[model samples]
Target chain A: MSCLDTIADYGLRSIGIGERVLPRGDGIGLCEQFTLIGSGLIWNVYFGALALLFGFVFATALALAKASPRAALRKPAEWFVFVFRGSPLFIQFFVTYEALVLLPQGGLHLGGLTIPTGWVTSAWSGALFVLFLNTSAYAAEIFYGALRAVPKGDLEAADAYGLTGWARFRRVVWPTMLRLAWPAYTNEAIFLFHATTLVFFSSFPAYQQRGDALYYAKYFADKTFDPFIPYPIAAFYFVLVTLTIIGIFGVINRRLNRHLPQAARPRLRIRPQLIR
Target chain B: MFLSCADPSALSGLNWLICYLTTDKQLMFYGSFLVVLLLLVVVAPVALAFGFGGALAARSGFWPLRMLGKTYTAMVRGIPDVIFFLFVPIALDQGLEYMRHKVLCPDWTAPIRQGNDFLVCPAAKLPPTDASPFYQESYGFVLAVIAFAIVFGAFAANVISGAMNAVPRAQLETAEAYGMTPGQVRRRVLIPQMWTYALPGLSNLWMILIKATPLLYMLGIEDIVYWARELGATKSKIYAYPHPDWRLWYFLGLLVFYLLLTRVSEVVLKRLSARLARGQATMAGEALRKVGA
Candidate 1:
């Protein structure tokens, strides 16, 4: 078959859209590797994008709860963040997969509603859930730090204007917190993308041979006994994706800091440790 | 092992539980935890040393050595480190055998690469191809450690180089003005001061190193993950334990172990950070000063 035929066959293979079976043996090459791995990028995007969007709101609440004077609210948020952040993501994956398996084999039933527990075994569901909690804890920590660093003058201004409670927080406190936390949040975003590679590598089975980029790369490496080729292709793809993420976040960062003078705007330096 | 727990098949209730927990294989499963810890303690310093040498060489006056060091450091940056974890052991093994083949069988003349096979002289074979299982296992573990050290060392070099730059130029200038040589200044002042700046990066790297330990399973080492899978699988009635699939519980136990490790490290590191902050000129030190006031 032609290269286009191969692409057509495996292009959406990750989501079970096209080919029913994976190509075997020397069937792998630059074309097959690029096409299939790119297909698997769908899962990565789905997990990263959705987890980030949802984690944003949850993290904000977590930050607020952590900063609250009420011990009931503050303590739970603190422990949640501590437990998630303190552990390695790899362990989290194993624990999650096993937990999902232990759930009643059939679908869960509640109040006459049948909830789908089958998909929980998937990388899309299982790994995404883990990544969601993991990022929430990390982002909550970042937001908490930013909340602490909200300038004393800003709070004083809110007090002087008699703007108490939600009014004060919405107008003054939240925006500044966002500005301070934006850079670290961007780091969290990149790390989430990198962490997506762990999805298939963990216990979550890549059903119907639908695996991520690293999975396909490893597949080729094992088959060809040549690590030099497929791995660099995967790396090149990741670097491109990483750079794209940086570019998009950099734009949001610009808008967030638009009120500042040109020199005062923070530059996004690539911090290596920013990714767990 | 409890002596009363001998009859695993006949026993029931808590007695059966005690017998199941004390099986010889279960003991080996527990032993893997120590192996993981040993790998971490052994690998971290070796990686740091490699990183130090790499960073120093990259900054060297000699052009070739500088290029080599720069390339070594940059090599790991572009690729997913998992690639290196998979590739390094095999590549190193083959590379060593190739060198030995070239040296030991100088009189023999044949291409080493023939189809899928990598042929080497019998004298050059690693573990002699008939070595004890212990030799084979130890050799594999050593190779894995070297691979981790090489990859993580590059990351450490990046951190160290930045930290070296973060140390104020004024300190070096003043040391020179005091009639100190470059080497002497580096040894006495720069090295001592650079650590305070490097501490944050180094600590972060240490955590990453801990997380990366799970990749040891991929390296063919029988790590905790391997044992978890082996011990946690469903056991049939024919077996002594005869338990349902408890792999999930085993994994949960592993998760808690990691969480505890990280929690303890955070507490210890916090104390270390406080110790490092003493009389230092930084934002944290400034906060400490205000607290004292």
Candidate 2:
């Protein structure tokens, strides 16, 4: 088949759309590999974007809780961040997957209504849940650090302006914390996306062989025994996504620092989380 | 391990638990934890050495070496490391085998790529076709270590090179003015001073390396994750010790293992950083000096 035909066939293949069966063996052309892998990237974007979005709010709460002086609030938050940050995401995926899988196969029944538990075991939700918690922990730690690092002068200024409690937090504390954390938060965001690749590699099985970009890349490589093409293709796509993430976050970072003089603004440096 | 462990079915309470824990597979599970420890022990220094070389190369006056070092850091930084973890071993294996194929089987007719399969000559197979199981296992492990080192080394190079730069250029100039050679300046001043800056990054890298050890399971090493799945799966009535799925517990144990490891590392690293900071010109050193005074 022509390259365009191949694209038409497998373009949405990773989502169980387009082709039912993947092209096999040496007969699989680069076009099919590229199209299917790119299709698989939809899941990566889905997991990463959703997790980062939700995790952002959760992390902010967690950071606040951790920063709180009350032992009741602080202890749990500290332990949560420590446990999640200390362990590898790889094992977290397995542990979470196993726990989810062991849940009642039938949906949970509350009175007449049923809440589905089965989907919680699948990669779409299950893996996403794990990623959500994982990113929240890492980001919470980053935010907590930033919250601590927020200048003493900034807080005094807020107090002097008669801002207190919620007003103080919303107007002064939160913004300063975010501004301080923005660079590292950007790094965490990139790390989360890169980490989305591990979902399929984890215990959560891809339903119907539909998986993320790395999964499809592994599929092509296994079939072809040629690591050269599929991996670089996956890497290329990831690099593209990473660059886009940098661009968007860079804009936010600039906005965060807009109040500061250009010379005083901290530049956005993409620190490798090699932590992944 | 206890004498009473022979009759597991007749046992109960902690007695049965003791018997179950001492099973052969459980022994292997315990062994795999050490495998992780071994990887950390070996890979830390190996990766640091690789980083040292890459950092020095980046600082080299030569343009080509500088480009190579810069590219190493940039390339590894951009892509998810899981790709390298997956890519390097097979690529290296294939590359190694192909070299052997060229050297040992010059007259071989078959193309190495046969449809979807890799067709290496039999003689070129790593550990040889008839090698012992021990050798084969170790060979796979060595490849995993190399892969980890190559990827982490690039990150380390970034840390180390940045640390090198963070050491004041004036210090090197003073060393030169004192008639010390470039090599002597690097040894006495630059390398020693860089540690305070490099420690935090290296400590973070150490934790990451600890976390990444579980990826060995993906590379087909029968690691803790492998053993957890195997032993924790439903073990119908046919076995000596029957049990329903207990993977949640097994994985929790693994998580605890990692938590403890990370905690210990954090404590040690904090001490190390303090030690490195003492008697230096930084804020930490100043505070330490005040305490001493």
Candidate 3:
């Protein structure tokens, strides 16, 4: 088949929409690289989108727990963030995959109902869980810094207005925490997308050769013995995805800080030195 | 290995656990942890030196040398490191062999890159195809270390260059005015002052290096991850430790080891940061002064 035909076949193959079998022949072309890796971007988006969504809420809670005076809340949150942030995501993937494997082979029995534990073995569940915890630790750190940075005057103003407890946090603390955290949160999102590259690379197997952008890129690299083409294609897609993440997160950050005078709103800067 | 528990049949509970943990393979597994630690200890300083040299070269007056340094620093940004991890070792091996092939097999005219195979004179093979298993493994480990150092050194160069730039111009100017030589100024003022700025990025890089250690397994090193997978895979009924696929627990153990290492590093780095900030010309230093005053 022509390269165009190959594209039509495998273009949407990553999400199981197109050809069942992968292309294996003389050599993979630019079209094949573009299509297959693009197909694999489906997985990258799945991981990045869900992880960011869940990690945001969880990370806020973690930030609160970390900032709280109560040792009960603070200690666990501190350790949780410490453990996740301290280690490599690759190990976390292996640990999670292994832990999931050790789960009772038959689904865990609860009140005569079998809760599916096997799903954890799939990249969707296993890798996502690791990403969730990893991003939460990172975002928690950002949020914690932002929480500290929420101007003392803002809180004093809240107190002056007779705001207390949940009312104080919701109206005053929460928005400010988000606003201060937004730029760093944007960095975290970019890294999170970059980190999605590690999912298939880790112990979490991409079932049936169905994997992410890096996975297919790696596959073609192995098959063709050519690193030049496949890896750059993967990198090109990732850079685009990373820029898109920055763009989208930047918009949300603009909206979050729209209440502030433009000068006061934090500028979203891309400084992701940390990939994991 | 507790030899007192001589009988596997007599062992139970805690004693059984101790015996199992101390098995020969487990000892090898423990040894791999040391391998990881050694790689880190060796690679960090080596990579830092490489980075320092690269950064200095980039800032050098010579045009082509500066471009070379700049390119080395910039290369890491867009590429996935795994590509380098895979390509570097093989290429290095082939490159070495090719050099040896030219020297050792001058009379032979057959092309080295015949078809897909990278053929070389048998005498030129790295670690020799007939070498001991230990030599082979060690060769692979060395290659992995070199690859890691190359990648991480570029990252360190970026951080170090930034740190160097962050050192205020006034410091250098004052040194220059004082009749200090350029080398003297750099050594006395620039390097020392740049570190406190570099510490944060360097510490982050250190943690990343720790995380990246597990990729040793990918490079075919018999690292803890490799051992974990090997020992954790289901053993037959005939084997001493018959268990279900316990690779997850082994991996979890590796994860905990990394986490603990990172936690310790975090504490150490924080203390170092505090120490570095004590009299520096930063807001942190000013805060320390306020507290003291």
Candidate 4:
């Protein structure tokens, strides 16, 4: 079969579009591999993007809470970060899924209402929640470090100008913290994106065998008994997306550092070792 | 493991719990934690050696060697490590078997890869198929360790190379001026001074390596995750210990174990960093000198 035909059939297969079922039986084509795996990229983008978008605000709050002087506020925040950061994310998914599964199978009881607990065991909800918390912890640590490293002079300037409390934080402290944090935060973001590939591999079973890029890649590898092709294809897709992440974050990093002199601005260096 | 606890069906309360935890499989489960620790201990020095070699290669005067070294460090940057974790072992296994097949089965004419099957001669099979289960399991484990070492060696090379560069040029120059050979300068000055700079990155890598141990489950090795899942599943009444799904509890135990490991490692790494920092020209060393004075 032509590559275009394969693309037409399997292009949106990951989202259950085009082909109603995945290709099977003898001799799976290159086009099927590319198209189905490419289709799987959709779920990866979904998990990474949504988790990161939601995790950012939570992380910001968490970082501030961790940096807060009040012990009550600080202690929980610190514990949350430590718990999530200290453990393997793979275990987190397993534990969360198992815990969610043990919730009353008939759903939660409320006054004249029932909250469905069954969905919590599915990848869409449970895995995403795990990813959300995991990224929040990592990003929170990065942000907390930047919060501490924010120039003392910047806060002093804000104080000297009589900007206090919320106004001071908004006008001076927050932006500077973000600017300082952007580089390491970029690394965290990239790692979190890479981590989303683990969702289906953990406890959360991919309903209907629908899964992320790595899942389909593993599927093809299993079928073909050829690790050479499918795995590298997945790796290629990941590298492309990783580069795109760097590009997008690079633009944001430039914007964050724009007010500073070029020489003073911190460049986003790709520290490969920062990943978990 | 108490003598009275052998009959799990008769047990109840604390006795039942004791019997349940003392199963042979549970003992293996406990032993798997040591497997993780062993991987960390073994992989660290081996990966450090790989990293040192790569860093030195990247600094080599030879162009092809430098390119190979640069590629080693750069390849891990853009790809998800789990991909490598999955890929490296299988690829390495196939590669080794393919080489063996070439050497051992020259008379055979059938294709090594016939359709989806990787058909190597029996002699070429890793552990030779007739080998003991212990040998097979150990072979699988060693492959997993090598995968970890290779992937992490790239990260370590990145760290070590940066540390090598961070060592001031003037020190090397002074050594060179004293008529020291390039290798002698590297041994006497560059290598010794790079540790302080490398400590923070290496410590970070150690924490990362700790967190990555669970991926061994993916490689089909019976690591802690495997044991947790195996032990935690609900068993029927036909089994010795009938229970509802207790995976949550098992996982919770694993989580606490990891947290404790991370905390202990943090304390130890801090001390190591301080020790490495002594007499160095860095800020930490300066602070130590002030305290001593």
Candidate 5:
């Protein structure tokens, strides 16, 4: 078949479009491999984007709570970050899935209403939750560092301007903290995107084998017994996604540092050395 | 295991739990934690050596060696490590077997890649078919360790190379003024001074290494994850320990184990970092001097 035809059939295969069944047996051509794996990128984007969206707010709150003087608020936040960051994300997925599986089957009933808990065992909700928590912990640590590093002069300026409490935080401290944290948070986002690949491999089964990019890539590699093609294709897709993340984060980073002199603005450089 | 543990059906309550936890498989499950530590102990120094070589090569005057080192360090940047975890072991195994095929079974007529199959002479098979299970497991394990070493080595190389660059240029110049050769300067000045900078990154790598131990299950090593799943599955009445799925508990135990490992390592690393920072011409060193005075 032509490459275009393969794309037409398998392009949305990961999301249960075009093809109901994946390509099997012989004639697992390059086009099919590319199309299906590209299709799988949809899930990776889904897991990453949703987790990141939710994780950001929670992480900000966590950072604030951790930085708070109140021990009651601070201790729980500290422990949350510690527990999440202390363990392997792989273990988190396994533990979360297993725990979710043990939850009362079917749905929780309140009066006439039934809130389904079964979906929590699925990769979509379960793995996303794990990813969200994991990213929050890492990002919180970064933000906490940034929170601490927010200049004393900035706080003094806020006080001098009679900007008290929440006004002071919103006007001065929060912006400075965000500016300081942006680079590290960008790194966290990239890592989180990379981490989406782990979802299918973990305890949560990829229903009907509709999985992320790495899953399809693994499928092709297993079938062909050739690691060269599919793996690189997956890596290519990841690199593209990672660069896109950097680009998007870079734009936001610029806005954060826009008030500062051009030379003083911290450029978003991808620090590849740190892998959590 | 206790002598009474043989009659698992008779046991109940705490005794039943004890018997279940003390099963022969559970013993192996506990032993697998050691395998993880062993991987860390073995891989850290090996990876450090690989990283050291890579840093040296990257710093080399020769173009080809420098290019090779740069590539090695840069390779891990784009890709998720799980890909390497999955790819490296199979690739290394095949590469080894293929080499054995070429050298040991030169007379073999058939192509190694016959359609989808990777055919090799029986003699070329790693831990050949007739080999003992222990040898086969060991072979699999060694391959897993190598995979870890290769990936982590690249990370270490990045850290080491950065640390090497962070060393004060003045120190190297002083060594040169003292009539030391480049090699002597590198050995005497560059390497020692680089450690304080390298310690933070290396310590972080050690924590990551701890977390990555669970991926050993994916390599089919029967590591902690594998044992948790195996032991925690719902057991029928026909089995000695009849129970619903206890995987949640098993995994919880694994989580606590990792948390403790990370916690202990953090303490140790913090102390090590402080120790390394002493007498260095840096903020930490200056702070230490102030405290001492």
Candidate 6:
């Protein structure tokens, strides 16, 4: 069939939109691969975007908790970050899947409430939850470092200007911490999206053959027995997504550094956020 | 593991636990941890060697060689590393077989990419079709190691090259003015000084390497994850010490093992970093000098 036909049939295939059965055997072509894999890109974007959006709030709280002077608050946040960051994402997926299965098999025995837990094992929620926690841990570390590095003069100015407590944090501390953390946080965000590829590939089930871009890429590779084509195609889509992430984050980075002079603005560097 | 552990069915309570843990498969499961350690030990130095080569190539005056190194270092930036981990081993295996096919079956005329199959000659088959299982497994393992080395080598090269560049221009120029050759200066001044700059990045890489050892499972090596899944699955009435799915427990144990492993490494690397930082012209060294004074 033509590439247009392939796109029409498989464009929304990953979310169970257009086609059900994937092209197999001799019928698989480059058009089908591109369409299906691009379809799968939706799931990656779904997981990455949602996890990052939710993770930012938790990560900010985590950074604040970690930076808190109180031992009770600090210790738990510290341990949380340590546990999540210390293990490989691959193993975390495994452990989290297994725990999700076993932990709440029946229902929670609250005083009068019963909460079912089967939904936690599905790829959408379960994998997203894990990615959420994972990104929070890494981002919290980055933010914590930036929180520590917030300029002394900024805080002094806040104190002198009668900005105290929540107002002080909102006006002076939070913005500067974010400005300092933006570059590293941008790297963290990029890698967080990249880590979405690990979800279906790991323990979680992609019910109804619906999975992320890498899943479709691997499917094509396995079908064709040629790693050369599908992987590079997936890489191309990923590079596009990555460039988009850089562009979006660059805009935010510019906004964060807007108050400072151009020369003083710390340019975002896409270093390897290779730490688990 | 114990004299009385053979009759595991008769055991109960702590005894049953002990017997189950001491099973032959458990021993191999324990042995697989060493395979992980071996991968780390082997892959680190090899990757560092590859890194050094890439770093040198990046530092080269020639544009083509510089481009080659730049591309190698840049490969990991946009792409998910798992793609490389998956692709590299198969690609390397096929590449090797293709070369061997050219040499071993010079008279063969069939296309290598026949339809969906890679049609290498029988003689060019990896581990030879009739080879022992042990040989085949080891060959697969060596290929996995090489793949890890290649990808991580790029990461290390990025780190090392940045560290090389981070060494102040004044120091290198001072060496140049002292009549030191480029090679001599690199060996004496650049290499020695770069370590302090490289240590933080290298140490971070070391942790990443530790975490990535688990990806050995993806390459189909029967590492700890493989064993955890195998041993922790539900056992029926047919087996001694039958139990329900305990993979969660097995994985939790793995979590603790890794946490401890990383915690210990962090402590040791902290001490090592202090030693490396001594007498350097960096912040840590300056702090050391103040304390020493």
TM-score to native of every candidate shown: 0.92, 0.98, 0.90, 0.98, 0.98, 0.98
Best by DockQ: 2
Model 4 C-alpha lDDT per residue in residues A1-276, reported as the tens digit of each score: 788988997787777768677777564878788888888999999999999999999999999999999999999999999999999999999999998888898988899799988788889889999999999999999999999999999999999999999999998999999998898888888888899989998989887878899999999888888899998899899999989999999999898878888898788898875434
Ten-residue region with minimum lDDT total, candidate 2 chain B: B69-78
Off by over 4 Å in 3: A25-27, A161-171, A256-266, B1-7, B61-71, B75-83, B98-124, B180-184, B287-293
TM-score of 1: 0.92
Off by over 4 Å in 6: A103-114
The chain A TM-scores for the candidates, taken one by one, are 0.94, 0.97, 0.95, 0.96, 0.97, 0.96
Total clashing pairs for each candidate: 0, 0, 1, 0, 0, 0
- Give residue A212's error in model 2 in angstroms: 0.8
Please report the TM-score between candidate 3 and the true structure.
0.90
Candidate with more favorable, higher DockQ: 4 or 6: 4
Report the C-alpha lDDT of model 2 over A102-159, residue by residue, as the tens digit: 8788888899998988778888888888899999999999999999999999999999
User: Which is superior by DockQ, 4 or 5?
Assistant: 4
Deviation in angstroms for B188 in model 3?
Answer: 2.7
Q: What is the i-RMS of every prediction?
A: 2.4, 1.2, 2.5, 1.3, 1.5, 1.1
Give the chain B TM-score achieved by candidate 3: 0.95
Candidate 1's fnat?
Answer: 0.39
Model 5 Cα lDDT, one tens digit per residue, B44-161: 9999999999999999999999999998887777778888888898998899999999999989999998767889999998879998999999999999999999989988898999
Runs with alpha carbons beyond 4 Å of true place in candidate 5: A273-275
Ranked by lDDT, the better of candidates 1 and 4 is 4
- Which residue pairs show collisions in model 5? none
The reply for model 2, stretches above 4 Å from the true place, is A111-113
* lDDT per residue as tens, model 5, A106-188: 78888999999877899989999999999999999999999999999999989999999889989899999999999889988
